[model samples]
Target: MLGELWGTGNLFRLALPDTFLGYFLLLIDIIFLAAILLHFSRKTSFNSIFEKWQWVLGLSLAGFITSQLLPIPLPFTNQSLTPFSVFPLLLAASFLNPLAVLIVGAATGLGQSLGQTNQLFDVFHFAFTGLLAALLLQQPFIGRLYHFLRHPIVSGSISMILPAFLLGLSTLVISEAGFSLAALDQSLYTSNNALLLFLFEGFINGVLVLIILKWLPNLRPRQTLIPSPTQRSLRRQLIGNFLAFSIFITIVVMAVVFNLSISVSRRLVLNQMAHNAAIASSELPDFQSELERLVDAFDNTTLFTSSNPVEAEVSLEQIYNSSLLYNQLIVVNKELTISAQYAPGEPEKLQLSEEEKLALNAVFTTNDRKIVTKNSSSVEGLSFIVPVMDDGETVVAVIGRVTQLSINNLIVGIQGVTTDGVGFIVNEEGQVIAHPDPTMLNAYWQDEENGRSLSIETNGIKNGAYQFYESKSNTRQLVYYLQEDHDHKWTVVVSTPYAVVLDLSLDIGRPLLIILLVVVIASFIQLTYQSQGITEPITEMVTASKTMAAGGNWTPSIHAQRDDEIGQLSQAFSQMQRSMKKRLNDLSLLLNVSSDVSTNIDL
Candidate 1:
């Protein structure tokens, strides 16, 4: 056993600090002092206290015998189970007073420890267990629990199950703590097998207790021993009404504040998004101009001027290496044949797609730069097509750079503005050209099924608008869009969900509600305590006055501690009682004299 205490150095070994141990001992001392005070104040007779002792002691002795004679052995650990020892503690806690319960617990722990290893640690273990169990099973809490269990409409299974479950939880704590304290082998204390055994034992003990209490109905708590205060005064009623009114007003104020805050927050978020969109619009044109200049310079090189595929290949590699943006740079000849491909190992004479061919024709015919986007199922992304003009101002070779617009990366500044804010770019054709979600790319701006569109034409707006769109998931999104008029004719879209904004409002409201609840509870407790100071004295005076009025030779004096209005009333009542007693005496004396004169006359 000594070796087990120090061996293996298992993880379960609790390195409790000395200061914590000192504080724990001090707390226990305080609790014991409190219990003593409580016990003496109640002041039950010695015989009654002794009778309780006898019952508890006998139950402890019985449990001791059972544990020793036929000890239940546990698997996976060298520990004997003695759940029966809990019976005395439970019994003492149920019907006996607090002091009696403690005594029973101490005795039972001592008896069990002595019978087993005679270890001081074992005694403390059982004693601590008893203390916790007794504390949980005391007075008002137990009374309330009993009432809940025995309600008229409650089912039998429910009544039994609830109590049993609660008992199991309490027993689990005791068992775990007891094992930790008594365990010399830390490995055994931390083992899964040990935990399972303790759980089983706790559950079994709880079920057994329920069965025992059921058979011995006397052990169960029937009703509350302490009487509840019943007197209600006008002041008390007013206080209650005022508290209710305050709570109602607080709730209404919070609701109004929440609505106002959400409105302001939503407007601010929309304004921020609009600001971000404008910034992106200004910045994107600069990026477009820079890219177009690069493409034009590359077109003027010997690579495209000489129409040499070999030279163009080398020049395209240099241009692709210049920026991180370009995925591929292609040089198309006057015949619309791919002269050279920069993105590695492609044939020199690749045929252009019908959409690309059409875009090439428009670039030559219009003699202006055109951004052509492919919204086909197989193809996506943008192509910037610029006409390479000869000295005679005729369109020669067309220079186009194939690149996907990454709105997710470009619009990263708007991410922290709102939790659910999103930004995307749409082309003139009303196809989603650039979006954070890859699945939405090349998909039409209008939902085919819902007929929801982002364009002003579909929404019946001239330039810009904020429209509500319900997705396939039935979630409503607040979309704010503005058209970019710089060479691309693309629309910049920023959106967020209405629910997310509302949740933000609720987030602020929840803490306020909690604060209100805490304040109300604290106020009620304080007011109740304060009310007692005034009401108790008044109640005493009223009772005493009633007794005096009923022909009893008694004086009413509250002897109020405070020098308030209640104290003055108490003093006046005392004076009135003295005066009334004197008058009654005078009347009695007169009656006696009259009676004596009548007797003389009769004689």
Candidate 2:
């Protein structure tokens, strides 16, 4: 079966699974397994049924068949809860040597490969797990300890769960899946469910093995008497418990402090962004109102009444050159033709597209001031349109001003935004009108490449803070936005990288961490010094007891100087040792007298 599975080409699929790293890892696993097989073959003898080729092959086949055929789907995950197919391999660990266990493991992997492809790491993971179980069971002390406990649950859990857990952990470390508290949490509780599934399978397999051992006692491995546990000194127990408690408390306190600091820092950053956003929102309308006033003033000029393009052009030029805010100033007559236009430095004829002409005509017909924002490949800016009227009744022409740099300057000049942060204006349609980067101008704010939408729902909210991942920089950003009601509704946004907040939190935590380190070190030193006062007398008593047991003098040389329990105990121990020596001396004298009396009687 193993040869057939291997011949199916599934086992060799791992040789090149998408990357050179996969190939390298496959080679390493193969070499390590081969080395284990070679080393164990020399050291292990095939004297047991578990080591027989027939039993190993049969168990391997069973494991593969059960795993492939029977799998129960786990709730809320793609993972399947399967029968513990590796039960036989774990059972074999108890009775056979590591070599036999590894053989079965490899055969099982071969069979699994026929059914599942690209599980090269899994094959070695199972093999190493079995090897570990076998090595552990083969130890005399551990085997005897398991026998002494005699509880199938305890025995099964130890032999099966421990090795499986260790092997799974090693696999995690070696695989692309990282080994950290965060990674483990994500794997167990989030999308990656491998770790939890592995442990669940191990536990089920352990129980199954325990049941089989009970049903077939003859198949169980022989065990010896478990040695008694050595007693620990009072001083050792007290010191160990004290240190463990201290460390545990320290960890708990540090975790609390760290979490609190992070929470507070994040809140402060959010609040700051919100405040800055509000200020920008207020400033936006004020700037827009000023532009509207300027356009209105330009509309009341006499340049629109004149038909001569040169005089109108000269007047527009003076107005355009007066302020850096206007990119271009134009005058359109009732026919929607650009009569005159002026731009900085070089004068060019203004050509209006049909769409732009219709938009300007609408303002002329309405005879009202209107704000029109343009966002396109060739042009990107806002156009403020105010109608020029004849004798305060009929609309004659429209005077308009196009400005891009003014709004960009307004957003860039907003105070309280950090140098690394960004401030931008998004129109009602979610299109960015002004930004620090010219390339980003006119881009959709919600576009994935620009800035993906926030994960949280912001419905019915006018102003608030939120967070979203910025794909451009691959960093999370803390964003605060406020909707401004001006000539056109606009959303002013201020954002900074979330890492800055984390750095601030870290700055806050640094002192706490240093204090924790110092406290731990001081506690350790103090405990060592204080424990010596209690442990030294007990250590001497233990040594004296050992000497007395070996037929040497038992008196302990301990100075009972301190007025404490340990000192009193030391004094008591010394008195007891002296009494024991005197009794021994009396016994020796009595024996000498008896020997002399017997000699005299014989004479």
Candidate 3:
């Protein structure tokens, strides 16, 4: 309490270096005030201003002593507790007028300053805590607090929590700011422990204040002239508190619901996008099977066995014309030279390039198919080569075809539908194989670009979704991807601008907003009904009362129809007005009788 700060681990300590001097000064102040209080003990007038000062001073002194002697340790902190010393000062402020509160604050601040290193300015910071509490007590909202405290259900719990929160809030702000200004090395507490400690302290002190208020009714703050304790309405207090709490809860619920809606929307969109991408990728043809069919056809043909080149060329042309696998077909001899060829507006016979010859040799020796890619300025094509056996083991000829491959063919169904959305595919070689924009085909991208990239491997693409900023488009996009299952050679990706996903969230939000609007309208209508009920009759009664007081022959128009407090008040007012009128009439009659008697005596 008095000797320790809140935090631990090199961060918590009393600010004053000279602990002995600080405690000594604090003790001397307490002793001095105590001595003065004892010396002045006499049969003084109970309600005198002098007596009030003595009480305030005595309370401050007791607070200082309490802070030193009965410090309660907080649960989570080491030697950290609020010096309930400050609580007595709060008690003084609560039970006294502004001038008395100010005096008590000064005395309390002086006593607290002794324990602080910044003796000169710490007094003001300590004084501010009481000052702020005093100000809050004077506010109209506090009238509701008083009524709320009177209720048993909340009295035990809220009375402690509310004051704890307020006092802790002020204490934290002042302590931190003061320490910062003094350039002291200290921490308030570990994380939120300080708040917890303050809360505990407030709970204890709140119980103390309640006890005092229950037993010592005379110590309560004197009521002010405007809307004082006598004028405070229980209904108004309850309604006001309900309105404030309801609004707070509504705002919190709205925020929670909004976040949950957006989260659900985002999750649904991602799942749908990924599903669509998987379907698109599944539609891709099995290139390996297509190549195998072409190989089987050439192996069964008798054209390759013909000795005449003319016959072989004619037969190859017919085969190529009928086939769906290739755009061009070439028959290579054992020497890896093209003996026969079939193509559109091209050479009938062509020489194999060094890479093609190696592929041809590989096909012949292994008796297996070989695939090679042709990349040129004109077109991108794939060639498949298979050994053509004459009978059992003789590799008489090799059949090869160059098929033009289009990346756009991979994603054909959906295009140009979404302005800010695109679907594309990446091959194992880290190249964009299939894209909405044909120009991106065969273009290689770095592993990481603009904060996103495809998962690439040597054999094929490893599918996964990712996000990135498209610099040219200047937008953030949500991406979903899936790799083709047949060969795992290409990954299909669907990307849409992030705003599109947010728009999906708005779809759900619009209805909620409308519902909130409807609720607000309903609340407004109810508030109007309730407010009118309170204000109208009060206004009429006030007018009638003023008229009667001014000697006007105004009859009370306020009806006591409802079986409620206001109705009862109206009936009471009417009864009182009638009584006043009857008394006035009786006094007038007596005055008339006296004047007549006096006249008769004079005659």
Candidate 4:
């Protein structure tokens, strides 16, 4: 927590290094190029060899403009593209070639830079998504993913996620490059604290892009190219999406499960601190009760007074030997003279605190006074004071023990219960008061230096107060705390960074992820088949249609056998050819008859 509290941290990037940045942007370009060369090579006129390029330019400009002008901005939010990007990319991807997409992607990247987070790191997403969709939509397998996921919007918005992830990863990599240690951490997101951010963005943007892609069919230029998301395609899309999603989700489950395992290191430390804190906290009440009982025992003793001068003074040695719970006892006359003193040590050498002396004086200042006080020992133990009374209702000397707040026995008991994870207690100021970590007592209440202490002022600790803070310095540790005003109302916090306590989600998620992965793979494979085989025929028909246009009359050259997309293309081509030929022949016959009749009937 040495960093700023209110905003994003080193997660922010100052500048981008080109070597990494280049790959991200280049990917977009290549995808664009593929779309242009393979799908929609622009053709203008017999002489304008490069007229198609104009569409590319138009789309690029459109992308730039939309990115710059996207109307809304989300909070603490990092976005790769804008809501307006949908409108333009939609228009461009639907109408322009791959080349246009690549160029447009560049423009979109630029726009997002200007209008969005603007960090050099932020552009990776802008570049990624722009290129990803451009290249990926051109892919049969990926396209199949689009269909199976039941998310066309994903196709539409993949532009947002890829770049966002790229940006996030880029920012993380670049910022962390110099630190050899952090790079070695197995928990990438945990070490970086960006796992949730990336996963969330990926999921949400994934869904959006999926939805948009799904919607593209009705909006495409070639109605033939867009297949109906009929039951079959839908089913395949569902399966593919399920599988891809499942893989990542499984990873997530693993993280959660691993997060809870105390064996990992951090959770173990936190639990110990919490347990110790609890012991120290709970011990105060027990000590208080003991002191109160002693006070009562002495208060009821109407044996001696200042006037009687403790007429029945008992021997100090006898009193000391007779008492089992007390370490020492003293009997004093009203003249402030000690008549007898029992000794755990040399009674003549025993001393009391100023506060304790004052409490005693308060009892002496008035008649029949009784007082209880606690004192801190400079070396060991605490001190308690209670004034004795006489039958005449007169005040006598005050006496009590010094070791009142010890928790050695309590700590031992707590340690026995400390099984998988340890627990401890933190004082109001985040100090490690009583810890399984013996070295921890009286320490500050922070996982990181100054963090807990600093926060205590802002976060007051009342009776039964609880809080948690992850160590920024130690990423794996989670400080779990429960403040219970149990008797003493101490803040009993249990720190368990491990998920063993709340990891039922992993149990549920593991199987779900597996099932999802299997389904997604199946769907993706099916989509690949559909694009390569089912839709291949239609694509071929398109090729044939081009060949027909290149030739003279349009004839049924398309040949397909299946009843799927390709077969439909062949049948359509055949029908169009028949209709055109019939019309052509009829026109020729009518023209010939008219010409002959005109000559024969010439006036």
Estimate the overall C-alpha local distance difference test score of candidate 3.
Answer: 0.57
Candidate 3 C-alpha lDDT tens digits along 105-191? 555555544442234333433444454555455443335655554422233233233333433333333343242311111121222
Please, what is the TM-score per model?
0.47, 0.61, 0.45, 0.41
Candidate 4, superposed: residue stretches over 4 Å from native: 1-289, 299-382, 389-406, 411-522, 552-559, 564-566, 574-603
> How far in Å is the alpha carbon of 392 misplaced in model 4?
10
Tally clashes: model 1. Answer: 0
lDDT of 4 by residue, 200-261 (tens): 44445455544555676554433233443443454455554555576677677666654554
- The models' CA-based lDDT, in order, is 0.56, 0.63, 0.57, 0.48
Q: Pull out the clashing pairs in model 3.
A: none
Q: Candidate 4, residue 535: CA error in Å?
A: 3.1
Question: Using alpha carbons, what is the TM-score of model 2?
Answer: 0.61
Positional deviation of residue 425's Cα in model 4 after best superposition, in angstroms: 8.0
List the lowest-lDDT window of 10 residues for candidate 3: 181-190
Give candidate 2 misplaced runs (Cα > 4 Å): 1-247, 294-324, 331-339, 350-404, 413-419, 446-461, 484-488, 529-536, 554-562, 591-603
Off by over 4 Å in 1: 1-236, 260-279, 294-325, 330-342, 345-369, 374-380, 387-399, 405-409, 415-420, 427-431, 443-491, 497-515, 545-553, 561-563
How do the residues 355-425 of candidate 1 rate in per-residue lDDT, one tens digit apiece?
Answer: 67787877667666666555443433556666667764434444444455543455665454566667777
